[model samples]
Target: MTAGPRRRGPARTVLVALPLAVFATVGVLAPILAPADPTANDLAASLLPPSAEHLLGTDQLGRDQLSRIIHGARISLAVTAAVLAISVTVGVVAGTTAGYAGGFVDRIVSRVIDMAVSLPGMLVALAVIGVRGPGVENLVIAMSLWAWAPYARIARARVTGLRASPHLDALRLLGAGPVRIICRHLLPPALAPCLVYASTDVGAIVLGVATLSFLGLGIPPPQAEWGQMLVEGRPHLASAWWLAYPPGLAITAVVFASNLLGERLAVGDERPSILRWVLPGRLRVRGGRALAARVTGVPATIATTSAGDGTLLRVRNLSVAYPRGSEHRRVVADVSYDVPRGKILAIVGESGSGKTTSALASFGLLDPSAVVTGSAMWEAGAAARQLVGLTPRERRQINGRRVGVVFQDSLAALNPLRSVGAHVDEAVRNAGNPGQRTAIRRVSEDLLHLAGLPDPATVTRQFPHQLSGGMRQRVQIAIAIAGEPELLVADEPTSALDVTVQARLLDLLARLRDELGMAMIIVSHDLAVVTRLADNVAVMYAGRIVESGPLDAVIGNPDHPYTRGLLDAVPRPGTVPGTRFRTMPGRTGAGPDDTTGCAFAPRCPDVVPECAHQQPRLLALTSLPAHRSACPRQQSDGPALAAETARDPDGV
Candidate 1:
């Protein structure tokens, strides 16, 4: 899937990483690499400048500056290694544990991490050294104490963000325990950022140790150190320049290497020079990323236009594909549905079924690699817009401003740095409100309250992390409705919340529809999750809608095997005790066009021989004009399908 790349990753590994490697190697073999004893003093050669014997000249006491610098590399690198090891280990463990075990423990640990970060790191090291006295052990401990907080903070943020992810949800569904989920799944991604941060941290530790040694608290005298050499060379800075320059250059080289290497690794690209990449923003990057984009500006009036017909959004044969190798692979194929005014349409499917892709692709919200096609006539109004081919500029006028979205992951959607008020206020401004500061703040609080947050004033001041899952989702709703959008698209908004919270959010959505007369398209993996929120439901399988109709019609008389399986999986009110959830017996990761015949034929219990040979088109059922099913076995009254079925019986 990642075959097409415009640029190769940063080649700075040659420039920076190799130098850092050489630094480590020199540190490891300092004794062998150094020509003379760094500590051996020669009165006869004292104060001699650079020559054949002493390459970097001699310090005031005639200690070979090159040897001292080489040995000093050993001390600095060792201290950095020790401190990094200790800090990374403690930080990752503490942060992972706290992030994994949330609520009070997470709050407590987060506060502790914050305090640790707030402390003067150098001062903390100094205090630790003051108590324990100067030595390698004390220096390592002091530096480690100073260093651990940043790693902890990084890990905690990473883990916290991932805690409610679908991957983790899937793990839990598979009966994986907490330890397995955290260690096997969570640790790898969390560690990537920490390791990258550690690359930059190498410089900080080396500099810290050098600073302490320069102040006489680190590596205590006679043993040659870079900082000690600098101190000795201080008086002769003007007369003999070689004394300070070599060690100074050595320190600069190590620091520069670490910083550049970290920058290269973190960005995951070769050109950290001019290009910037982020997951979602003004400029977004994803798999086989499109580096930048140009304007496809929307006509000004389309943002305020309304559909006169009952349908708010009428999508026909909508297809979305991403480049896979040389060809485009369809993730969503010929998918069609509608969101009627003041009604909720639910798109339900298993993970990778492309429910989210179909909804997001309609709005230009998918990764830039996605190539979308077909007509999405975004309103039945006279001034209707075709959303499929719209530029980002045009999509923006409709999406965030006219049609709001509440993402499945509210934590990911909301900025961790920005408070609730800031997010809402920004949305309000972006929605074209452009109100005064006090007026905007007031509107933001009102919107938060409208989204079902009781204490809007208190909630406004809190960050995304400070709020619970339900609160965060509510905040997302507030931000979404800042534009008073006619349409709302919520992608599994309540999936991460508890039953009570989920119920409350659903109620809020229903209430919003009744009050604002807004249409909504809600996407979900579990059919049961959105049953309460949706008026009409479309059950998607392998990127195709298997069945779609009114909530009761599809739920009660599910014609497609996949739809039946989804209905079976939902726990019933009068179910027998200890009954296991009935899951379909196949993976849900195939494309609609991957199989020539029925995509679900292999997994379908009712699969006939003909089902393996031909794909079935979604046709109107004999029972109802609005209801439709893709399974040929589900009798349809459509003339073309009926005649084809009667003539061939197998659609061969």
Candidate 2:
């Protein structure tokens, strides 16, 4: 179910392509390759066995069996290809249109597809073929009528799911039309599964055509069709086995090959070659180790640092960068924060603000392509461990067991194929508790209940897709808490839900935090959510923290201009109907290649000339202890920073 690219090896390629190549060659060259006229009769050579002169011998009336089989491939392949083209084309177009343009059109199309699929496909094909008498053209038309129903169903389902995808919304915002969105975004990924289905359908279609011909309702006698040939050789089964065997073997081989090819292509098993088994386990391990090291680098081990008082997790001088040609592009720069035990620290920022990057780096979750330089020290009892320097194996020991993460989209984070119980069970196993396997169900139910799921039993049995957005999120929380983690990271957990659901989920998280007494970090762009949940808040711009303090100190009296602009931008109930919403003057200054100056200088409303020359260090405020802002012009407070009482002063 992952959308990641599949790797195909040479063995798999050969497995899929070689059979197809043989069939295609035979079909294309039937006329040129036949040795003798398939319809030519010779009473003397009738019922002959396979011989060098006639090769697969002669059928009744002296027709060359080899010639007939070769020509038969042409008939079967051509008809099947035509039927598939028509069916797939009609299905894809109808399904895509209906799915993209929902409501009336979708309902109408869904009903029609349901009706068509409900009626037996073979029965419908038989009825049509019976009404239109034998002939290859009529036969193809009969099969295509129901063939399209399956394709339409598949296409509709795929498109319906993709319509809700965040990527499609991004495309719409970029001004892409419906046609472009369908072709560029929807069709490409959907086509893969459809292609797999179509491949498997080939063998079935071939068999159906052959069955019709054998019944004397398809390609007539002397035409040299495989099914007709089978009928002719039936009476001479004992005396002349060659007449039936050749065509039967031909049909069997082609169908078998088609099915095998489809299976290999669908699964994308890269190590299909037997040579893999021949290699020694030690050599294979060495090779894999070398490859992993080359790609991801060996995990560095940093010595433990002294822990600060009451700080459960402390991050210092954190910077994350990715390789760009010979140099590196920093995404997060010199970020620092500390999470006190049993408290919430919210990192609030705009989209490109590097809040999420810094959080991910603290947990060692970022990819190896990113070079993270920092000291993320976590206090465990009397000892402290440097998370940034731990090996992947070492990190795994604490990740699910001591630290848990809830991602933005619950649907994307949870496996669609797995039941909620299975997800929780895996988490329990990972925790490595004694007798966990035996008590998995009980433990999972308890976790679900703790996460506030109404019917734990029902939810445990249901898959992620079956649940609503809020329910899926609750299930995700259950999974995260199954390990009884000490530190929980909720990364925009309620962003996708409606206001009512968001509030409920936030309340649930707050309750969990208080009950478990776990240290938590909330990464978000929504200031309302942050103020409601976080005790301390850090405002990030570009890749660095511009302000940090208690939520009340920061929101009640914002020091940085960027933070003030953000507060003003929030829509309030008292704003005049015709007035425009307040917005920052310019966009974020973060980019792959940027100048060495204050990142918010380009957008700052009261930008001083000195702002563009150098970046300011985070300095403490005289008014509030532990309150800091990265601004040189602290004496000049803009009008926008003035308190507005009419706004929803109660935090979101």
Candidate 3:
């Protein structure tokens, strides 16, 4: 179940802020509040307990207990702050570099981090201070040396995970520099938990300084510190317990507050799922109709699937082949399609149908081992260009700006560390927008709202992990559509959603297409989904399209046997619940070379002698000039035609 909205009120904020404020102030103002000189020699007034004049009573130093406690504050606060700073900075940098660079650098860094962690913090600090001679600087050096290793190790682990995240991949595809991507995407999440650690560590580091000082190995006593005071008060502990107790309590208070605040802050902000916020807002309604209009400029023919006719994107004879183990085979073969301005075209196929591969081919984002050959041309307004044969820089200039994609998995698509608003801002920035930071953030909030997220301002402040699956998907849509590109490629955009959520997402996409006038390519395994949003549908089987035409004509009377089989697969409620489902016979085989005959023949019940021996070209199936099919016997054989003509008699 989705989490309910977080209550926002002064009580919660105060509960979080009060302790932190108190601790911070005490730590920072310690030096000014000592009732007596912490370092003043008081050999005469030594060993006195609670008294009216002495208040908490005099210590072994004849000095006021309160004064000594206050003085100790300065030393502890400095040590803690210094250690935290050194550790966080060193850890984030080292880990980020190691994670992002990977390979040899990562191995070497990991080894170094492991080696460092083998030593305990106290031991390391003691060794460093022992050699350096105990002083403020030496003590700081000791604690920092001990502190940074753990931070580095954890940060390294987090970075390693982030390096492989899809958001990073998406950023790379958009031409983000290594530093920009790492700092923007990788570091934020890595550092948030670290922030909590760092906050808590301050108190511990301060205590370490006090410990060394107490042991005569920390800050030499001309400078008043809690440990020094404790050491000085040791001789009179029985009588002057006030001296030691006050300072001890002060340290406890600061540490406790910091710890509590750290834990609370660590919970982070709440972020709802983007799919909820974005998809429904953009597409859905109570009436279950696509009330939104198609995008301007797209041809009406394609708009029926989503609207506009500007030839926003075109792909010609695209092919992509991935290696099996070490052997080579083409996974996607000779695919072609066009995305008109402000229109929706759905690519329908089962798993391994090459729908995704085909999309990947258009952008030259195939795996290194997968050889890709294709020319994709795209135009928006006056911006006409060819995607194939373009250099990295050239592709960078166009990808996020001219073409945007909503991946199947929104969580995979978004950076877990970043807030929804930031991701949207990134898309806008990548598109070459000149807005200021404030404007960018505002636009992000607005986009989140448009995507259907509530409490836009608060939601904008949340990281991806805070959101639900649906909300995350909505944010992904927001980011993808943020740039307002001419072409939007949705690869199984709603595949992971439940029926209601899926319907809502479909409605949102249809609305956005009409409102923004953007052309869309919806890739899915379900033809029903295509029928909902596609003006034109292309049925793919074994990496090739077997049929193509208007959605209504194609669904009403599928010419290809494979296409008919797909339509029959959509489940219908209230049907005989336990009835066995009809399924296509054989799995999609390997590529063109894997089989000499039609790839579907093994599964095609009407397979003939000629089907196994000859390859068939996509041919016009009827007088409907736009309708086409790849089956060789489309013009002949009543048996196969009868099966193709058959519908779900049960209305399922």
Candidate 4:
């Protein structure tokens, strides 16, 4: 059954690809294929008419028209190939250099291209030929000089547009040099259009060479070139018309065929002929069917292997790093945690502290540039799966079905074009419950109602813009729970909402957690929100979890100086009017070149000399074994640490 499409692919490719192959072969083997010497002339047979003895008859010089036409293919094709090579090479290098370098270099190159493009191609060719004198070599050189400008403009525009791609920025963050980035990332996408342009240019180049030859400037006379043949036949046109028509017709056919092939390449129709069928994997039609079958089939069930003590997900020694010159900067360093079923574990940190990075790593959603080292064991229903090294396809099978995520911005997460119901319907389909149309609709409404929307039916019919901020967030939660995933990772779910809305949304999440019995990972910088929702809290600083324990213990009895600072910075209700709000003493940022010692040492209020010299390891408190702090001076009493506050030098 699959062989039908596979068989047809080669036939379509051959139909489009055959003419170019035949033309190139005949041109390359002109000497062997020609019936007679193309340059030889016999006065006795001058202008002989078409007959069985001499096909295409004789030119004005009595040379065989068929042989001259065949040999002309060699010259035209050779010059066209040379022009393509020289023009494309020079244009690509100059254009990519200018676009990637930008600023001064871009301005200079753009002006040069403008000036070059302003000059007429024919006039520039004429001036070059005038200086160097006319010949096949000079003609090629002159054509290349003008031909490269167009390709340069095309390549420059393409590179300029792609300079800001996120993939390229990620490469830069990974320590890739400018040369490597331009060559590997910028050049490939720019090459497609340049190649298409080169294809179409072949016909123009052939026409130029012939025009020069007809004007008595190219290939001299007895070469039996098509253009020279045309010139020779013009004077004898009144008496013998066959002499002019054959060469003209041959030139027309070759140019038209080249153009036809160029158009096919531009439109992406020239597929790999026999290779399409021989290599079954490359066939899209076959691959699509196979993918559809796999998606629809019963999902592979996993055996639930406990990480220990009923933990739903266990992450051990999780670290994420990006390259910096010769070394790597760890963003999340040796972080470990566990979330039991129906429990909320909040990862709290300021921006760039690696809270989100660590959360994403557990789900195998980190970028390719990040080097993640650790194990994220997810216990799903009856089976346990390791998420760190799963292939993308394998990860896809579990992501929406076993683990769902509600991103920070509801507006960005919900497609503006799609209705609220459409988003939920997609999640329902992804959960492998793609039932009949009516059933899918009912399931979508049920999921929305479960997410706490008052009118699930009305909300389902509205677009993302038609809903309020809280409603959009509710829709997002509805989509997240549509799959009934065992674990839900909410990254700053209520950060964008007003205080009233934020409180309502938090309550909705708590209700959902209880009703669904799903493990939840709440990622937030807001400690108040974390206090209200999280059963356990992990405080992060400079990519490492500086302190972690039960919520009341970590917040009421803070241990690490950084954690203490964060708690002090939060605003409380009893503060007098006109008083300045507390702020952390130092700014926050992280990079691969972090010092060997503690990352938060510079910002620590009670920093000691040893804090800058030795990196602290997260160790369990002797008093509370489950509670851990990375500080060497681990105070036994949380109330004592919380009582002490450092006075800021710059008071507002």
Best by TM-score: 3
Off by over 4 Å in 2: 1-309, 436-438, 573-576, 591-595, 635-652
Q: Candidate 1: what lDDT?
A: 0.78
- Residue-wise C-alpha lDDT for candidate 2, range 405-465, written one tens digit per residue: 8877777776554468877866766666434333556667767777778788889878888
- Ranking under lDDT, best-scoring first? 1, 2, 4, 3
lDDT of 1 by residue, 401-519 (tens): 77898888877676564568878877877777654566667777777887888888899878889999999999988888777788899998878688898889889888777666678
TM-score of 4: 0.53
RMSD each, Å: 18.0, 16.7, 8.9, 12.8
- Per-residue lDDT over 311-384 for candidate 3, one digit per residue giving the tens place of the 0 to 100 score: 77777777787777877688777777777767788889998888888876777665545677777777654667
Report clash pairs, candidate 4: 302-383, 303-382, 303-383, 303-384, 304-382, 304-383, 329-592
> Can you tell me which runs of candidate 4 are displaced by over 4 Å?
1-22, 258-537, 541-546, 549-623, 629-652
Candidate 4, residue 98: CA error in Å? 1.5
For model 4, residues 1-652, the per-residue Cα lDDT tens digits are: 9878766654654565465566678889999988999988897898899888788898766888888888888877888899888998888778887888899999999998898889998788888888999888898899999899888888899989867655455445434578877775566556667777776787788888888888877767677677887898889899888888877876776677668766766655442322223322211211111111121221122112122338888888888988879978777877889898778999999988889998988766666668888888886557887888777678777778778888776776665544687678777776767466556767777777767788888998788889988888888887887666778899898887899999999998887666557778999999988889999999988888888888988998887888888888788898898888767777775442465677776777777777766767666655565667878455333443333312211100
Q: Is candidate 2 or candidate 4 better by TM-score?
A: 2
| CA lDDT for candidate 4 | 0.75
